[model samples]
Structures are given as C-alpha cells and as structure tokens.
Target: MTQPNTQIPDFQSIMLPMLNLLESGEVFTLNQVVTKLAEHFHLSKEDLKIKVPSGQMGLFRNRVGWTRSYLKKAGLIHYPERAKYQITPFGKDYLKGKPKDLRIKHLKKMPDYIEWTKTFNQDTNNKQEAEITKEIESQTPEEVLASTVDQLNKQLATDLLDKLKENSFGYFENFVIELLQKMGYGEFREDAAERTGQTGDNGIDGIISQDRLGLENVYIQAKRFRDGHVGSPDIRNFIGSLALQGVNKGVFLTTSRFSESAIKTASDSKQQKIILIDGKQLANLAIEYNLGVQVDKTIAIKKIDLDYFEE
Candidate 1:
C-alpha cells in the first residue's frame, strides 16, 4: 500500500477541518476524532507515531486535541458527555461563513473565547498573557510547558552553583559528603567518614566508604574555587595523596570546572579511579537528589476520567 503523507497539520490548520467533521452534529469521542482527522489529513504511519517533545501524546493527536479545546472555548462545539463532543448551532453558522482558516485570531473575536481566556490570564500581566498566547499559537501546550520548565531548571542550577561558591570550604565539604551519602555512597554511615580540615593536608579533604560494610573506601578532594579551572597538576597531586593513603579510588569535587588536561590525567590513571564532579554537574546532582533545594510549590493538572462515564 502507498504510504500517506508524513506531514502532520498544525493545530490552527486542523481547526476548520475538525469543526467541519463535528458539524454533522453526531456526538463523537476524542479517539474517534483523532482517527478521522488522521485519515482526513492522509497522515502516514510515521506521522501517527510522531510524539510531542514530552513523548506523552502523538503530535497529530495533540494538535487535534487542542483544536477541540479551542472550538469548545469559542462555543462552536462542546462535550455533551465526558470525552464526547458535538457541534452547536454556532458551529454550523461558523461553517456557513466558509472562512479561509479557523485560528486563535478568529477565536479571539469570540466573546466566549475572550472570557474563557480571562480565567487563565487573571494573574498574568497583559504582556505575559500576550506572550503566552503567541507561544500557544505556534507550539503545542505540552511543548510550551516543557520548554518553560527546562529554562527554569537551568536558571535554578546556575543560582544554586553561585550559592555553593559563596559558602565556606568546610560547609562545601560537608555538602559534598552529604550528596555522596544521599547517592548511596558510604550508605549514610556517619562513623565511616572524616574531614582533613587543613589546607595542603596531603591534598585530601575527606574520605568515605563505597559500601555499608566499609569493605572499600573512596577518597574525596573538595575544592571550593570561584574563578579557576582545576588543572592537571592539582589532579596529579591528589593522585599522589591517594597513593600516600594507599587508596585506589577517589572523587574530586570542584565548584569550578576542570581543564582538559586534568580530565585526561584522571582518565589515563591506571592504578587509581578518579571521578571529577564540576560545578554545573555538582549543582545538577544537588537538584536531582534534593540536596540543597526544597520543593517550593507543586502544580497538579487534571483531566477527565473517561472510564468514570463509561457504561
């Protein structure tokens, strides 16, 4: 069989066709519309499998879903029962106009649509609302939300690293130990850890175990530097320190990045295993393990339970 076209229509482009499909006044489920719309667009198997950035839903289905929402908000179509939709008199009149395209701009001219938008815009300023609407027009809502969260996490990581740099060396050492423990190193055995507490103290800062029984130990060298790269000489010196202690494994944590030579030196070491955790990585770890950050807020998104309405 010949493959259908692979290009999925944008949400805006899907609006008119979708409204026309519903204007038959037959109540249809979302899955039914998704199937019909895919056929209408001649979307291929590859197109049907295409997912949004979050991989939560297919690209075509997501656009079609949002188109349904837009039509519903504009009072052109609505859910008569959960997960089922049908067109209204307004929708039939809308089709009679034979508009070139049904889009957010056309919906904005609708009083019901404007009022529905106000519910979401109550807390946002005019500029923010406009920006949000612009993004909604170009991208799926899930894509927009994911992009926002990624941007926030990056900024949070930068801020978190900056705070780490401002803290004292002792505090930084304690933080790294706590992070490692949280990650299952030393198995949270408080008795199996120690701090060197002095500068140039054989180039070692702390030590912890790799397992609960303390069968093996990992040496740590925590450097809280604000503005310089950890160099190869520093790594070699730490290696020497580990050799003095007769340890074969070490982790070097720094609030600044490591040089290429330093990384290579660690990788090339045959007798010892050295792990380097740079500032960005350190902050990300802290975030991942909830070491230095707290949950500020939680937002819950709700959707209809189709099974609840099923016979």
Candidate 2:
C-alpha cells in the first residue's frame, strides 16, 4: 500500500513466503494467493503498478505465478482443483524446518525437479554463463523466455546484415524495393516498383508507388556501406533529388547506420516526409515481415484450461 520506489522481489524470493501461505493445506485460488503475497511483502503501489515488458500482466503477479509453478514442480504444492492450490505433505514438512528461503537451488535437489529440468538443454558450454545465471536467478519465467528470444533475434540481425553487405548494390536496391512492397507500402503491386540501375538516374536508387493506382510515389535511396555512417551531405543530395522529382515522401534505407547530422538533416527537411531505416532496423523488419528469414520453429507455452475443469 505504500508508494515507495522499490524493486519487486524475484520469483525465488517469493517462493518461501508463497509456500508458507499454503502450509495450512487449505485451497486458495491463484488471485487470492497473489493478493496475500503482495500484502506479506508490503509491495508499494508503484511496485504493484509495474508490469512485465510485454505489459500484459503485473510484474509482481507474474513472479508469484512462476513461484507457484516452481513450487508445484518441486513437489511442494499441487492444484486441488481448477485455479485452486494447496501445499502438499512434502511442502508442509519442508516448512516445519523453518527454512529461510526457498530457491531454485533448493528445488534442484528434489528428484521431481531434477527430472523436470532434464528437458532443458544441459549443455554447459555457454560463454555467457555468469550473465545467464544472474538472469535465471532474478528473471521470471516469462522474462527469461522473452530475453532468450530477443538475444536470438539480435544475433540473427547481425548475421543478416553481414550477408546483406556481401551482395551487390544493385541487389541491395532491389531487395529494399521488395521489402517496402512486402510491408504494404506499394499495395504489393508487381509493376509498382523499379530500381534505377544507373548513376544517371540521380541520387534515387529506386521508386515505388504509394498506392495501386500510382497517384502518389515513394523515392528510395539504398546505401550498402561496408562500414562507416552515411553523413549529412548524402542525405542533402537525396533530399535535393526528391525535390527535383517533386516527391514529398521518401525512404532512405541503408545497410549501415546514419550519422547524427544525417538524421538531423532528414528531420529538418521542410518539404518532405523522410524515414531513415538503418541496418539493424532493416534486418528486424525483414525478420518481422518474413522477407529473407524463414520460421525455424515455433514453441507453444500453455497453461491450465480452467474452463475445462469447471464442471
């Protein structure tokens, strides 16, 4: 109830108090337990208001939810019915010892816990072991899953950029045109885009229709740099090219970053709406729109179907 700026307790820290609440062996719904734990820890209003990165659930609630899952996996608790939980005989016995903290290390000692974790990749070759350890200790299950996916995507983006730089400038220009079309900029019209393959075509590398009828158009400038930033002079020339073509909207796509002056130049341009997409942003878009990347696999994270057991 207090309004203090304090860090929310990690899921492991919540596990002990959570199991203590269930020691009475009485059934408590998940929400009921969450409310009790929030009070037990005296979580501040600001803390209660905090949410997971996805913003779909409250932070403390997510930690407590994962705490219950860990306890259940460790044979310390079990669902008595849909959405209701009670401490098992093992849970009560463990509480009798008056343990100070219930943690993953404690759970790992249990046979059921060991068996459950066997499904995970047990390879110890990870170079980020220290960081991974810290993450697992402090992050909720949802946070861990999200962090893993983000790291994977970042690595993929780097790889994609390297591969992109290996291609010819003409190929890169055509790729950007197709990328824009795939993103629904040109209404996916086959004849709506064309790459200007000659330097005589001014600074614009490509052009695409904004709509199917081609009433409006977008001028594209694709820069495939091996290294170094695209500077202001290049942006000014692209702007000048757009001005000459009487176009008010353009996309500047690059396989490298843009300098601060370049970004400022585009932002300060009064006559045109300019979007500057860099290497990382371009790679992320490719991944999102499934342009150059294919889905390697999909994971299904599920939960109890309370409605199925309601009867």
Candidate 3:
C-alpha cells in the first residue's frame, strides 16, 4: 500500500482558527495565537517565525487582523474601536455554512471566500486612490520622487542597522568612511592624530581628502555612541577642531542619532560648512554604496513607446 503524503499547513491555516477563536469570544494577543496555533498544528516556532513575519499571520496582531481585514472588506466584519474587531451578521452566516474539512485550498472554493477576495482587492484600490489624493495635495513631482526615494533608502538603512552589533562602534566608523568613498569622496584616510599639535588634540577623529596629496581636506569626527544624542556642544567642538586644522569642510558621524539642536547648530554655523551624518544617514550611505552588502538582483522597469506605435 502507498503511504499518504502529509501536508503542512501554511499561514492561512493557522489564521482561520485564530479568527474562529476571536469569534468564539476568546480574547487573544498575537503572541498567544502564535503559541496556540503552533501547538495545534504541531509546528515548530522557527517554522512559524518565517511565515508569521512576512505572511498573512504577520499582517495583524494575530490571524484575527487578516481575517477581519478580509471580512470587513467583504462587509462581514466591522471595527467598533481602533484596535477592537468583531464579525458582522454576514460573517456569522458564512462561518455557519463553512465546511468541516476546512483548508486553505477549500476556503478558495467557497463562495464567501471569492466574494471576500473581490472586496479585498477593491479596498486596496480605494486605499491607493486615497494615497494618490494625499500626494497630489501636498507635493510637487520632483518632491514626490525624492520623498519616495528617501523612504526606500530609510527602509534599506533600517534593515542594515539591524544586522550590525550594538557595541561595534569601530566597525561602524569604518563602514561610514567606505560609504563616503563610494559616494565619490575619494583619497580618504583615518585616525590621523599624528599631525595634531599639543593642547590635547581638539575633537577631530580623522581627516579625509577629496583629492591626492591632501590638497582638499574633509575632516571627520566619529562618535561611538550607545544612547543619548550628540549635542550642539559636540558640534561646536568639531567646528573648533576644524578651525585648528584649517579645514572648512567637515563630517560628523555617529552610531547614535543626533538631536535637532546638533543638526541646527551645524547648519547655523557660518564659520565652516559642516555636514551632519546621523545613524540613519550613515546606514543609508552604506546601502547606496553596497559597502557591506551585495545586490542579489537588479530589476529594470520600462514603459511602452507610444511614438513607435504612431510611426
């Protein structure tokens, strides 16, 4: 006799029960649902982690959120409060008629599921309409593109930041220099304290040149910070150090984020043109340069040529 192949349940499988649990008057958090779903399906936490973080399970606090999102779009659910979700009369009817041998594949075959999918797509279209309206209200074409790129850069930066160790400040400094170099600022060197005369050697950490033979200099002050922002005082000291070195262009890089005052101070200073690169910017620079990361694939998008059709 041939053995039956065992099928492992996906995110939707776990979500249905969680939704059912919520409908049955059981209050549960995302963590609680994850635990219970894992046990019920005999799934390992690792397996659940992969699906939950990126799949439907991750869409809300629990499977309830995705269910509610779908059901609400289908007019089968309604939100009473910001976070609280409940099913509607249509949802109750759908659930009552739902098959006992419920599976993700089976759900697709159901009429209610098809209706929910259609409504879900329509809701998404409505959301896109709202976003387009908001964007049109507030920004110019150039500003919109710039804002979109900045958002993408920030998301990439956050991903890289998560991979870095908290105490690896030295590594962070090196990462920043490499990023700047990739950004067309070449002839760079680090920790050049040998040229500093007495008086405790000011606040500068390193000096980088844009060209050969140290002609055009860009001084840098690298701070390895864990918490608490870099203050205006720090910015002032960096400017003072730049003066001592007779350099007008300077970069202040830190692992920790900078305060608004620090940024304002740097911008407000008339003595020298100081550039402030905070933790977020530092990460973005790294991504732009592909310093510590590699590109897996490149996607190119193009539009149809209407001129060719006319010709």
Across residues 139-216, which tens digit of lDDT does each residue of candidate 3 receive?
Answer: 986787677566555545544654453436556556666666678776344432222222475876655677666678
What TM-scores do the predictions have?
Answer: 0.55, 0.58, 0.49
Candidate numbers, best TM-score first, in rank order: 2, 1, 3
Worst 10 residues of 2 by lDDT: 118-127
Residue 140 deviation, candidate 2, in Å? 0.7
Off by over 4 Å in 3: 1-153, 164-167, 187-201, 300-311
Cα lDDT tens digits for candidate 2, 38-90: 89998876788888765667888878877877787677997767678999999
- Highest lDDT scorer: 2
Regions of model 2 farther than 4 Å from truth: 1-132
**Candidates sorted on lDDT, descending:** 2, 1, 3
User: For residue 308, what is the lDDT in candidate 2?
Assistant: 94
lDDT for 220 in candidate 1 is 94
Candidate 3 clashes between residue pairs 3 or more apart in a chain or in different chains = none
